[model samples]
Target: MVCATLALALVGCGASVPSPTPTSNRTTSPAVTSSPETTAPADAAAVFPVGEPREIATGLSAPWSIVFVGDSALVSERDSARILELPAGGGVREVGVVEAVQARGEGGLLGLAVDQDRRLYAYSTGGQGNRIQRFALTGTGGSFTLGAAETILDGLPSAGNHNGGRIAFGPDGMLYAGVGDAGSPQNAQDPGSLGGKILRMTPDGGIPSDNPDPASLVYSSGHRNVQGLGWAQDGTMYASEFGQDTWDELNVIVAGGNYGWPDAEGTAGAAGLIDPVLQWRPDEASPSGIAVVAGSVVIANLRGERLTVVPISDPSTAAASYAGEYGRIRDAVLAPDGTLWFVTNNTDGRGDAREGDDRILSVGLAG
Candidate 1:
């Protein structure tokens, strides 16, 4: 949403990795690592199982995100500034589109989620700043009633590059928002600041009354460009984030937890900060959207161009089993047919582009 770019003096100039994209597809490209180790098996490909990822739709302009509504509702798209619905039988049509959104480099519609009530949410970097808006959907795979977007919260740092804007709802039923540093590394450690933090709020554009700090909107801090978030069955929030070059991470989030981002990279734990449940080389896994299913955490990689499934049995444990190589995966979710539905950003201006490279793909995994 915000499109906040880091300052040239801070760290935007001589860049090593590519920037963060806001929509479903971009020519750009980009998951994670050893535990404290959560992974599948030594022969992960053999242990969990796999399926072919076919191009379910084509001619999509940078499809950035994907979310399945109920058993038949499917929606996806990227910087083209539109959310398209894919019917169960076949065919596609526009469900809803943001009219005032000005599409630019790495900015537009990015993240999306369908609540238990069938309401849809779009996280978009618009003309002003990144904001979350709600939309109504029909059971026939059609969504309408583009209601007024109530600005539940605002004033996120708008970085042209690292404006992290992934939003999710935890099992607790509270809406969670992931925001980047707005390019300011200093803010990552500042508990008072909202940038580079995971924010918790109510479904109706309101913050919960029982948040860690009554006046604070930030749930956790010390994140660089947190793009992906999912909740474990035990209600543990696992957030996937981008690190400098050495340590990208998958953190187990607790309310009011301080993850220690720019302060520390990988698994090093500070006195008051929590360490990552898993860490990876930035080049190996620039993880974006993440989905936890059955007993695994499925991380969608942006730069590494792979999807990694880490297996775990319970919380309180430190290690997890890992395995996977689904390339260029971005947004991912468990489909109704016991499959993992994921989207690709192979054409988002970063990674290698194939014919119909930007597509929604699904792979079978044990339910």
Candidate 2:
């Protein structure tokens, strides 16, 4: 239930994996809705029987990104700046609404991308900081409309607590960002600090000529709050760090390289510092939001509610165990037809869950 003072306001005291993040869970399973107006019982549990989880959508509130676009499942709600639009058996809608946020505690309208012409991109926390918007999608088949919302980039740093939003579009189409040190940690080893970095712009934010300090748009730097940003289709990039009670990483993001955070929270000899193929123990895993699927990389653990399945490596390094447990997981997606979408931080205030209740899980990929 977060608030060990948000893990001491973003891990830094004597953490390095000494443990303390997990809280309550004997096993309860049965709470996953998409919330557009959820009707309930389409499917929320099957554990890989292949073709079950289809509760579709139902009144999401703290949903926090789910992605699909065509078959529909577009959720994102960090305090309800709203974006819910889930369809395929039920039909629930709310199309768009993430403009200029400032929604308190962990910021609002948090992360949601739908590129490849589907438009819709957002990474809110605005009111003067942390932004990235774009709507564009009128109406076609199953339904859509959101047209005006543009705003492509802002100061970034809403601070109610490490505002590292989380956006993704990689595969070299560029557009990746995970920023978070906004709560400060020497700005995560400052390299002209973009705040505990991993920001490779250009989807409209521009700053890509192979960026690596072309004036510092930073693609790497000792991170400490980067909330997951996957890319293993052979393009590399795979972050998930959030340790402070000691080690909770999952890195593999090297370009400017240097992920030691506060000098190293997971592992590193400090020669360039970059360790964590998967170290987790900040009470099971504080690792947040991520998805890779088939090649295996699906992480999500907002204070270790569990959902890790590492195994998409090469020079990715370390992490080959622990992949059972799923409750406090905060945002994850890999859907097209491959299936594996998750979202639930129990209202993000810390699980006890409420309001159309958390859910969107449709897992199954263990080949």
TM-score of each: 0.82, 0.33
lDDT string for model 1 (229-287, tens) is 88655455678899987878777676777777787787663567666666667876788
Candidate 2: worst-modelled 10 consecutive residues by lDDT: 31-40
Q: What is candidate 2's lDDT per residue for 159-266, written digit by digit as tens?
A: 887777888888878788888887788888866658878888888887888888776578887787888898755466678878777667666676777777887676
| Per-residue error (Å), model 2, residue 345 | 20
Which residue ranges in model 1 land beyond 4 Å of their true spot?
A: 1-49, 74-76, 142-148, 314-327
The local lDDT score (0 to 100) that residue 249 gets in candidate 1 is 78
- Model 1 has a clash total of 48
Q: For candidate 1, which ten residues in a row score worst on lDDT?
A: 1-10
